[model samples]
Target chain A: MSRPIYDRVALIGLGLIASSMAHAMKKWGLAGSVAGHARTAETRAAALEIGFCDEVFETAAEAVKGADLVVLAVPVGAMRAVAEEIGPHLKPGATVTDVGSVKQAVVAAVAPHVPEGVHFVPGHPLAGTEHSGPHSGFATLFQNRWCLLVPANADPEAVARLRALWEGMGSYVDEMDAAHHDLVLAVTSHTPHLIAYTMVGVADHLSRVTESEVIKYSAAGFRDFTRIAASDPTMWRDVFLTNKEATLDILGRFTEELFVLQRAIRMGDGQHLHDYFTRTRAIRRGIIEAGQDTAAPDFGRTKSAGD
Target chain B: MSRPIYDRVALIGLGLIASSMAHAMKKWGLAGSVAGHARTAETRAAALEIGFCDEVFETAAEAVKGADLVVLAVPVGAMRAVAEEIGPHLKPGATVTDVGSVKQAVVAAVAPHVPEGVHFVPGHPLAGTEHSGPHSGFATLFQNRWCLLVPANADPEAVARLRALWEGMGSYVDEMDAAHHDLVLAVTSHTPHLIAYTMVGVADHLSRVTESEVIKYSAAGFRDFTRIAASDPTMWRDVFLTNKEATLDILGRFTEELFVLQRAIRMGDGQHLHDYFTRTRAIRRGIIEAGQDTAAPDFGRTKSAGD
Candidate 1:
């Protein structure tokens, strides 16, 4: 077994990411003790039953009482409240971190609640799925995934220590400014989610009021957006609310580009459409080469089966 | 073994769909003989090597000679030329069908070329993946998929025989007016492709002139769009050109909805965003119930792993 990074680690939210963290810690023996808590007593019991944590607490305050490292794993909107609730109970000199999608708001909200002696290093593991809950995590979720670390100060030693913890759990850690991280994610993730949500909404309205044929004939392509649109409502709502400005900025850019294409379609400009579609194929090749995702055919089909 | 639907079937284009149809026919004994042709000698050779046709021909004219059923399986833009090439060679009273995404244009293009004694049916199978070419097809490709048929006052007996052929290959066939089929697919398939193309184009452009960093951090969600953007360029180019009006209408509606969300995001209207996202989730649930797609957790884990 590898050496443990921390004597005791506390997870303030036992959702998908936090549970995955617990599983990874256990798989790698990276933490001497892993304790966690959820917002409700039922989830705490569920987390305990799933063996996601060595110990489960009903409240965030109780969970962090003796943890050497505390991770805030709740939604961005709840980060400040959870941090404030647990701050007084945290062991002195503990490293406080997070797995929220938006790092800027998380740092601004959670940093203020950190005690003087605590190391408040804000981090966002760039791994997740549409599902949420204490039981929805896996040890390999963060395997080969990127984790952005946004430490308020340029303390190399402190950042390195935290990076080691993530590395031990099978993630590659990169350091960047919190604001830039949010903006990067706005273009890559938030804007895409918003677009997916809107398209699904259009299909739903089309299916219900316009015609029932939409769902009957959905396998053609409308089904993919539906899968993305089915993501947890509360979590996404918090995301848009917290990452408003960055999302808006990206959305504006997307709208401008979409308008140009829309006009081309309106004017029967097949060449414009063909040129745009052809251009996009190159980026997909780039993404495959970069290894951000699988290049295989989608829907979990093997290359042979997909063919 | 199941009975053959036609004594001899001729496929005018030996691409992915035609190859898949051949495999399906062979697996189900739906055709006594499958003859196929491609414009290029290489594709015909590839079709023979892949065992996609019982007899490979050098031209559409040669392929359709004496066949009971002739299927035009080329790109929509090539339908008219293919029909004209095979018109004189087709057997008297034979059933002719073309598998194209857009029905109205296909009917208008191919109808005039069909002889008086022939029955012409336009069809679109609601099934496919990112793969193309004669070698990328399988026997099960049409299983449990929808096949839309638009028969313009063609022989009812011929339509029944064709429906039986598709049904024997494990497809569910639905008949609709040619114009209606074009409009429905425009909203469901054509518009979605255009939107996905535009989104991928935006990301591709951003990745090119700006930075490769747009890809390195793609786990944020851009990876999904990349997959959609990787589809066959020529096929998608034809779809936009053939289904212009319906695609434009849906694109217009999509723009209006997108503008509202964009404005809401710009104004920081959290309630509006939240409500929209929530409504979209229900549609995803409906799609899951319809069994058109998997309801598996977007993440690779279940609720037992965590939220």
Candidate 2:
């Protein structure tokens, strides 16, 4: 096995991402000892019971003590508080990073708390399932996925070391500016999630369409939207709140495009609708070719009991 | 072995649905012989080469001759023409059914041409992958899936026989009015597909975010939309055109709900966004409980080559 990248790694939140990191670090020997902390006692207890972490601390500050790397894996809204609590406890030369969905706001909220000698890098891993919580994580969660780092004037060596840690956990790492990360994520993740939530909500609110009807007939396509809509409420809420500008901008574009398609449908312009659909099909092909998604039918989803 | 449901069955479009039906029928011995027809010679050749059909005919009219069951599996826009051509050739005491996404338009287009003593049942099978064509089918595609029959004044015996055939093919069958089926499907299928296409188009058209970036980071929720958006453009275009009112109605409600959530995000109303997201989560659980979809994360999608 390869030598551990960090002597001691502290995970400041024992949620899906952090727990997955713990498992991957253990699997690959990426870190010598993994310590964890969560705001809720239930989560801390659960993380300890899961046995992914070597030690579980009650406070963020206690978790970061003497650690070479500290990961703030809380909701983006909670990052500032966790960063402040752990700021004084972090080792002088340690690097502090986060696994938040939005980079710009996370940087704004947590960067100010880092001490002069400590390196602060904000990262957003472009991987997750709709399921959340510590138990929902697995060692292979980051395998073949991208983990983006926003160096933001941090020391190059610190950034390189952090990239190595993620790469050791089976991720391909890339570096980009914080603002660009936010805008790209808004287009790729945030806006899509919000649109899915809205569509599901519309189905819920329709009087003519019973909830049972929606559930029974969901195999027709709506079930895909529901999968993303089933994501953690608090985490997604913070994502939208913190990444407000870019998400709103994307949403604006989405609504504009939707209206044009709507008009084509209303006007009986099959050619226009067909042309638009054909163009979008090429993008799906691009994603499949780029190895971001499987090309299998229905994502090669296993049959449920109903099937 | 039990007797076959129909002595001769003709499938009038060798796409995913019809090809799957051919395989399922052959697997279960549900039909004595299956005759197939496609608009394109390439599809007809492929269907014959795949060996799912016992015989391939050049015209829908020729395929329906002497057959007790004739299935119109063409795109909704092509249904009327196929029905006109096959009407005179359909055998007496035969059943003519269609496997179209929209019911009301299909009923209007095909019902007028039904000959005396022939039964016309319109069905919408709530099962498919993002794939199409003759070879993109499997014997178990309909297993545990719903096949809704819009039996509009059809003979009771014909409806019962069709129901038995679907059940033999491993589908759970239900009966409903054409209008109700259209509205239900608009909520569950058509509107969701249009929304997915629109969102993907927005991403494709955005000048600032490169296509490569979107494809690389797609695992963060955007990939789900791409799967549905990648469905057959001609079929989807026909669906939107034929089921315009209900789809537009659902889309309108979608935009309205989206605006409310957008306002909540803009106003920093975390409570509203959180509550909305929480409510939508229940719908996903309901879908899982109903056996409409698998509960596994990311639809239990297999890792692509990148993984």
Q: Which candidate is the best by TM-score?
A: 2
In DockQ, how does model 1 score against the reference complex? Answer: 0.52
Each candidate's lDDT (Cα)? 0.80, 0.92
Question: Per-residue lDDT tens digits of candidate 1, residues B1-307?
Answer: 8678899999988877899999999988999999998989999999888887888888889999989999998989889899888888889989999889988888889998999898887788888776678887877777767899998688899999999999887778999998788878877777777777776666555542244766777776666666676777777878877788877777777878888887876677878878888788777666656656655555232232211
* Model 1: docking quality category: medium
Runs off by more than 4 Å, candidate 1: A152-154, A207-212, A302-307, B207-211, B299-307
**Worst window of 10 by summed lDDT in candidate 1 chain A:** A298-307
**Which lDDT tens digits does candidate 2 get at residues B63-105?**
9999999999999999999999999999999999999999999
Alpha-carbon runs more than 4 Å astray in model 2: A303-307, B303-307
lDDT of 1 by residue, A1-307 (tens): 9679898999988888999999989988999999998879888988889887889887889889889899999888889899889888988778988988898788789888888888988898988776778877878788777898998684567678889999987787888888888888887788888888877767666642343577778778777776667777777878888888888877777778888877876677778877787788887778767766654455443223222
Error of 2 at B68 (Å): 1.2
Residue-pair clashes per prediction, in order, are: 16, 1
Looking at model 2 chain B, which ten-residue stretch has the lowest summed lDDT?
A: B298-307
- Tens digits of per-residue lDDT, candidate 2, A1-307, equal 8899999999998888999999999989999999999888999989889899889988999999999999999999999998888888889999999999998888888988999999998888888998999898888888889999999789999999999999988889999999999999999999999999999999999998799889988999999999999999999999999999999999999999999999999999999999999999999999889888877788877654343
